[model samples]
Target: MKARVTISLKNGVLDPQGKAIAHALHGLGFDNVGEVRQGKVIELDLGDIAAADAPAEVEKMCTQLLANTVIENYEFELLD
Candidate 1:
């Protein structure tokens, strides 16, 4: 099975990197862009894992190491 995890900052959190990217876009004549938020995607190859158990396992990985869980939120999906 394959899994994908997305990690992102929660609402009301300041994102400096996202801000910088927005500023650069505006400088390049893309002023139409609004406030930008940044996130990350992680792809995992969980070989031989059952479909029913993949979500829980991946979520555990997120809570333990993949996400800060303070200012960030994480979600995942499994693929066959």
Candidate 2:
């Protein structure tokens, strides 16, 4: 099975990198952009552990390694 994890900054958190990207886009004449938030997508392949409590394991992975829970939130999906 394949798991895709998305980690993003929570609301009210300041994202300087996202802001910089948005500003650069505006300077390139893409003025229609409203706002931008940066995040990460991590894909994992589980060999034998795919069938059992995968979501919880993935959440643990996010909490322990993939994300900084202080200012970030994560969601994951499993695919066959």
Candidate 3:
């Protein structure tokens, strides 16, 4: 199975990178854009892991290494 994890800042957290992106977009004539937020995507290959256990396994990975649980939130999807 393969897993895709998405990590993003929680609400009310400062996102300087996202702010920079929004500023750049506005400078490039995308004035209509508003409130941009940025996140990261991680793809993992779990060889031979059963589908039933993938969620818990991936959640452990996220909490342990992939994300900073204090300031960020994560969600994942498993793919065959």
> What is each predicted model's overall lDDT from 0 to 1?
0.94, 0.91, 0.96
What is candidate 2's lDDT per residue for 1-80, written digit by digit as tens? 88999999999999999999999999999999978999999999976784678888888899999999999999999988
For each of the candidates, the C-alpha root-mean-square deviation to the true structure, in angstroms, is: 0.8, 1.1, 0.6
| Candidate 3 lDDT by residue in tens digits, 4-67 | 9999999999999999999999999999999988999999999999899999999999999999
Superposed model 3: Cα runs more than 4 Å off: none
Q: Provide the TM-score for each candidate, comma-separated.
A: 0.94, 0.90, 0.96
State the RMSD for candidate 2. Answer: 1.1
Q: Which regions in candidate 1 have their CA more than 4 angstroms from the true location?
A: none
**Model 3 TM-score, 2 decimals:** 0.96
Backbone clash total for model 2 is: 0
For model 1, where is the 10-residue window of minimal lDDT? Answer: 49-58
- What is the Cα root-mean-square deviation between model 1 and the actual structure? 0.8
Model 2 TM-score is 0.90
In candidate 1, what are the lDDT values of residues 1-80, reduced to their tens digit? 99999999999999999999999999999989999999999999999988888888999999999999999999988878
